[model samples]
Structure formats: C-alpha cells, structure tokens
Target: MTAPADVPPEFLDRLRPICRELPESYEEPAWVGVRWRIRKRTFAHVLTVDPDHQMAYARAVATDEPTCVLTFRSPVDELHALVAGGHPFYKPGWGADVLGMVLGDGVDWAEIGELLTESYCLLAPKKLAAQVAGPAGLCC
Candidate 1:
C-alpha cells in the first residue's frame, strides 16, 4: 500500500520498531482515523489507515489547555522543523524516535536510554512503570 505524502518511510520504519504492534485481528471504525493514546490521555493523535504508514499523532486540545500535548508545544514543532525539515506535523509514536535522537546527540547513547525510560514513567501502567527499566528502543 502507498503511504500518505506527509509521512517519510524512514520515519515510519523507525517508529513501528518502537511501539506496540497493531492488533491484526482488531477492526477500526470509519473516519474515526487511526489513533494512539500516549499515557492513556495526555496525548491522542490520528494515523493513516493505510498499512504502509506506521505513524501516529496527538489529538489537539483547546489552545488554553495547559496540559495540552507536548507534540503541539512550540518547542517540539520548532525542533522538528529544524531537525526533520517539517512543521509541527507528527506521524504518531515518532516521539520515542525523537527522544532517542534528541538525547543521543553523538556523545551519549545512554542519555537516550534514560529519556526512553522516563517516557514510560509518564506512559505505562503504574505497575509496569514502577518496574526497573530493561532497555530503551527495545521492542515495547
């Protein structure tokens, strides 16, 4: 299947390697769009239903919501723009990828390891989040 124009292949490949696999036996609703819920609430964004685009994004909240998604935050937009040559647009689950690139910066792979660890702190079930982390970018 063809991927949406807004998505990059490397980007999708990078993300699918990190997130939970889409359930093959499950079905999706019409026009509701593909969505991935981060931390179950803080973020929710649409994805392309086409099999090729392994991406996701957050549901945009009211502008005044302080707890709005970080992906929507200016820094993320600006950083992504400079880094990926795009605007605030995201392809879901890509945050984990960025967190790795952002934290690594050539000198520290371990820092990326830490950010991935903390990501689950704000993302996983309390019980799982409490367990000591095993590895970052390791099949989630």
Candidate 2:
C-alpha cells in the first residue's frame, strides 16, 4: 500500500498500531497529514512540515529542511520534562498540553507508544480511558 504524501510510510507504520490499540480510537486524514482520534478529540497527529510553508513548526524547530512531526497531548505537569532537552521534542504554541516531536533517525518507538497511550487517556472519557492501561508509572 502507498503511504500518504505528507508523511513517510515508515513513520505511519510505526504509529498505527500504537494508536489502534487504544479503545475506541480511529484514524483519519487531517488537513495536513494524519491523526488518531478518540470520539471527536484528536490524541495524536503526524505531519510533514515544509520549512518554507509551515513557518510555525519550522521556526520552533529551527530547521531548514522538511520535517516529519508528531504532535500529541501530555499532562501539563509533564510537558516541561519532555521538552526540556529540546531537539526531538518541543511544546507547541497552540495548546497548553500539546507537545511536538521530530520523527526521524534514532527515534524511540517504545516511548512514542507510551506517549500516545497517555495522550489517548487524556482526551478519552473516564470509562473509555480506563479500558486500556496507562503508560508505565503515569496515572492517566
């Protein structure tokens, strides 16, 4: 199967199962790339940001080349710790709890799964959220 034009197939392949395992979550095309949603809220979104066209992401990461980015929600308290080191992670401007991760080279698939699971818990209803285990050590 062909990958979507905006993001690489390998990235999607890695992400799909993690999101799929969440209760009641579904995948759909977003305006720029792809997103996984629980009910009506988006838990995770992956897209390619062209430095020339997507200035916000480009400026945040300070990259001259195109970047594949994954944006997901995190507990507000954990946001700082996640983005502190900087490069692969950054707090996005739009949401208080939203964080963006640069997806390429040496990326950690296990961490991504944990983050996405936590993200799903954040947006999902209590009943639905409890259906799946939260990330290790994190109480969602």
Candidate 3:
C-alpha cells in the first residue's frame, strides 16, 4: 500500500496494520511526524529525524546520521529492558513511561508489534482493551 506523503513507506508498512486493527484507533499529523491514538489518547508517536533544531527537545537522539524515531508508551520495566537490549532502542527525554526507538534497518518488527499492542492495551478503555485482547488476553 502507498504511504502518505509525509510518512515513511516502511513505517506505514510495518505499523499501520497493528494500529489500524485495534478498535477506536486512528492516525493524525503530530507536528513533524505522526501519532496513533486510541480513544483520543496517543499510544504511539513518531518524529522526523532532526539533528539541528533550536529546541533540544525537538532534536533527535544523538546518532551518526538522520533516523526517524518511534516513541510509544510502555511499562517501566519493559522500557528499561528495551534500552538494555541495545541500539535502535532508547529512552527519549520525555514522558516517564514513554520510550523511543530508532526505526531503521535491523528493527524487530514482531517485537515492535508486541509493544504497540501493549501500549494499546494500556491506553484503551477496559472494555475496548478486553475486546482487542481477545479470548486469551492476547492482542488481536
């Protein structure tokens, strides 16, 4: 499928399905990148790579080259584990429960899908989450 002009094709290919499948999920422009929301609350967001921005918060994490980063809400333990896992994942200096991961080559799409599912569960209302979680409490 063709991606939106502003979104990376690879990102759309990998993440769109996961986000779209969840009930009450939608996407919108989030300043420089995009954000996926459930019940009007953002569960995942992405930012365009920008090394030279006036606001330090706007700059991407220190990297050798430009790289888009996908940030998502995560449980604290999971957040730390992702960081401990190595490159491609790190904590952005933002929300206490939010973590950032560089999106590029070698990314583990399956793991990312799991994280997104978890984030959706966290933000989605209990009833909606239960519906998405299916019979075994696994993501749909």
Tell me the number of clashing residue pairs for each predicted model.
7, 0, 0
TM for every model, in the order presented, reads: 0.32, 0.91, 0.84
Cand. 3 Cα-lDDT? 0.76
Ten-residue segment with the worst summed lDDT in candidate 3? 51-60
Best by TM-score: 2
lDDT (CA) per prediction: 0.32, 0.87, 0.76
TM-score of 1: 0.32
**lDDT tens digits, residues 1-140, model 2?**
22332898899999999999888999999987899999999999998888777788778767778888999999887889888877799877789999999998999999899889989999999888878775454436
* Top-lDDT structure, candidate number: 2
Kindly report which residue stretches of model 3 are placed more than 4 angstroms away from their true locations once superposed: 1-6, 54-60, 134-140
Q: How well is each residue in 7-87 modelled by candidate 3, as lDDT tens digits?
A: 477787788898998888999888667889997899988765655431443343676334677888989988899888877
lDDT of 1 at 27: 20
Tens digit of per-residue lDDT, candidate 1, span 60-107: 221221111122112344335544642222323444333212111132
